[model samples]
Target: MRFFGIFCIVAILCCDLAAAESPLVVIVHRSRHSPISVEEVARIFLKKQRYWKDGAPVVPINREARSASRRVFEQYFLVRVRSDLVAYWNEQYFHGVFPPATLESDEAVKRYVGADSNAIGYIAADLVDDSVRVVHRLD
Candidate 1:
């Protein structure tokens, strides 16, 4: 019984450690002209930010629509899914609201957002670097 209790406690602690170490990050180009909050970041990711300081389009890149990290990001950041978010965009798209471009891979997103001054993307926090500044980390 004592050994079983100790094993359970250790397992629980490991799980807690993993959960506490969040891996999702909100990344932007090396030149993020504007300081932003998590909410504004969500707005930009949803394609609401139509322009940047240079009057360029705010390009937002995304991971797979159903990725595990994306799901968490959507819930915590965007507060919705691609489908529901699309529905939201549809309402705004008619009003001339443009949406962000979607990318399929971490490397592609990193490369694209890193090279574009008006671009932003998300990736596992471990993948963040000087090329991509981390604006937020999901926990």
Candidate 2:
């Protein structure tokens, strides 16, 4: 019984560490197969590029402001500090452009992106499935 208990604890800790280290993936609906670069993704998230090649409005979904995934996404993709990003959004608000809509969890982001052809969002790589196609990965 003692050996079993210790084994379980070690297994749980290993799982947690693996989950924490999972890469982040940017996803679109499964139907979207076009290649997108990091710069273009940044532009879309910033609301600078508002439409897809087919004239459909590009919808960028962000994880909530307080999420760790959001921090990573902004760091790797936006490449702007929080204060600078805030200032940029402030300027954009004046021009009628706004930051992307935010969802609270990876599951929600996946569902939204899966349902909308023009929508794009990011989630932990481990959560990815058939509902969405990964367009980028931040390793």
Candidate 3:
């Protein structure tokens, strides 16, 4: 019984560690019709740039707060939280500039951005599929 408990604990820990360390990836719309570089992706995440070359309005979508995925994204891609990022957005929003939109779920983000020409988002590296094109990989 003790051995079984120890094994379960070890297995749980391994699963958690694996989740915590999952690599994050950035992706753009499948119909975007442009090739993007890491620098360009970084710019979009930081809200420094807002449009693709084809004049499509670029919308950046983010995960919900408290999600493990959100932590990874902020630690690697975005540099701030919604309240703070909103402050940053507010500064630009009034100027006719906008920050990336926030989405609640991976599925919603995937569906909206994957089908739209003006949307982009980041998700787990392994979760990327043919419906989305990876633009950046976070270490």
Candidate 4:
């Protein structure tokens, strides 16, 4: 019985460690050549920065609020809780600015960013393919 309990604990720890190791990758269309900084990424997601340097409008895509990726992104990048973001968006809506459009899944976000040159989004690192370029990675 003691050995079985120890085995279960080890298995649980390994699963958690695996989850912690999977990174989130920030991605953009392959054609976007300008270097992206983390600060700029935060601004773009917050709807504070509206346009890219070439005059094209910045389109930021977000995963649904309930998604694990969204949680990780908010915790590490946005540094705000969902309720706080909701409040912020409510205020911004009054000013004619809107939050980034949210997709149902990482695949949807990847597809949208892959097709739109002005679009930027983040997804699990393992999901990244040749269709998009990775700008930054968050663990």
Candidate 5:
């Protein structure tokens, strides 16, 4: 019985360690050459930074609210809880600003970012390819 208990604990730890090691990557279309920062990513997602350095309008894509990736992204990148973001966006709505648009899946975000020079989005690091360049990565 003690061996079984120990095995279960080990399995749980391994699962958690795998999840923690899954890397999240921020990507932009390959054509975009400018560097980006976590602070800038936060600004773009919150609709504070409306344009890229080259004078192009910035388009930020977000994952669905309930996605695991979205939860991690919000915690590490935005540094705001869901309730606070709701209240923040409610205030921004009155001022003609809105939160970034959300895509249904990581693949959708990747495709959008890959096609648009002014677009930025985050996805699993393994999904990155030649069509997009990673601007930031969170491990």
Candidate 6:
């Protein structure tokens, strides 16, 4: 029983450490732009600012609320608690400005952004590749 308890604790700690170390990166279609500022990225994700400078409608994609990347994006960029975001979105819905569409996994987000010229999304930095260009990285 003692060995089992110690093993469980170690396993939990390792998982937590891995999650903390995984960097989050904001990605957009490779053809769009590179190294966009964090503030602009935040505005895009928040739906406060729409349309890329070239007159293309910005399509922001989000990971599921409970995903690790989503948590980091909400806490760091959005700067609001989940409940407050819920309320904000509710208000936005009334105004016909819905929140960004959510995908189940980072792979899906990458694929979506890669396929759409105006789409942007966030994912683990390690998952980034030539398919998408990273605009911002959050450690």
lDDT of 5 by residue, 77-105 (tens): 99998899999999999998877899866
Model 6 gets an lDDT of 0.84
Candidate lDDT scores, in order, read 0.73, 0.89, 0.71, 0.86, 0.86, 0.84
Task: Give the per-residue lDDT digits (tens) of candidate 4, residues 24-108.
Answer: 8999999987899988998999999999999999999988776667778878888888789899999999999887999876778
Minimal lDDT window, size 10, model 6: 12-21
Kindly report which residue stretches of model 3 are placed more than 4 angstroms away from their true locations once superposed: 1-20, 79-90, 93-98
Residue-level lDDT of model 2, residues 1-139, one tens digit each, is: 9999999879855654454478989999999888999999999999989999889999999987876788888999999999999999999999888789998678889999999999999998999999999999988
Best TM-score among the predictions, by candidate number: 2
The model with the greatest lDDT is: 2
| Alpha-carbon deviation at 121 in model 3, angstroms | 0.3
RMSD of each: 8.3, 5.9, 6.2, 6.4, 6.5, 4.7
Candidate 4 segments exceeding 4 Å error? 1-21
Show where candidate 1 strays beyond 4 Å. Answer: 1-22, 81-83, 93-98
Model 5 score (lDDT): 0.86
Candidate 1, residues 56-130, lDDT tens digits: the string is 877788766545556677889877756798788788788886566677556678888789887888876666778
**In candidate 3, residue 49 scores what lDDT?**
80
Candidate 2 residue-wise lDDT at 96: 89
**Across residues 1-28, which tens digit of lDDT does each residue of candidate 3 receive?**
9999999879855654464576777777
Two-way TM-score contest, 3 vs 6, winner: 6
Candidate 1, overall lDDT?
0.73
Error of 4 at 27 (Å): 0.3
C-alpha displacement of 14 in model 2, angstroms?
Answer: 14
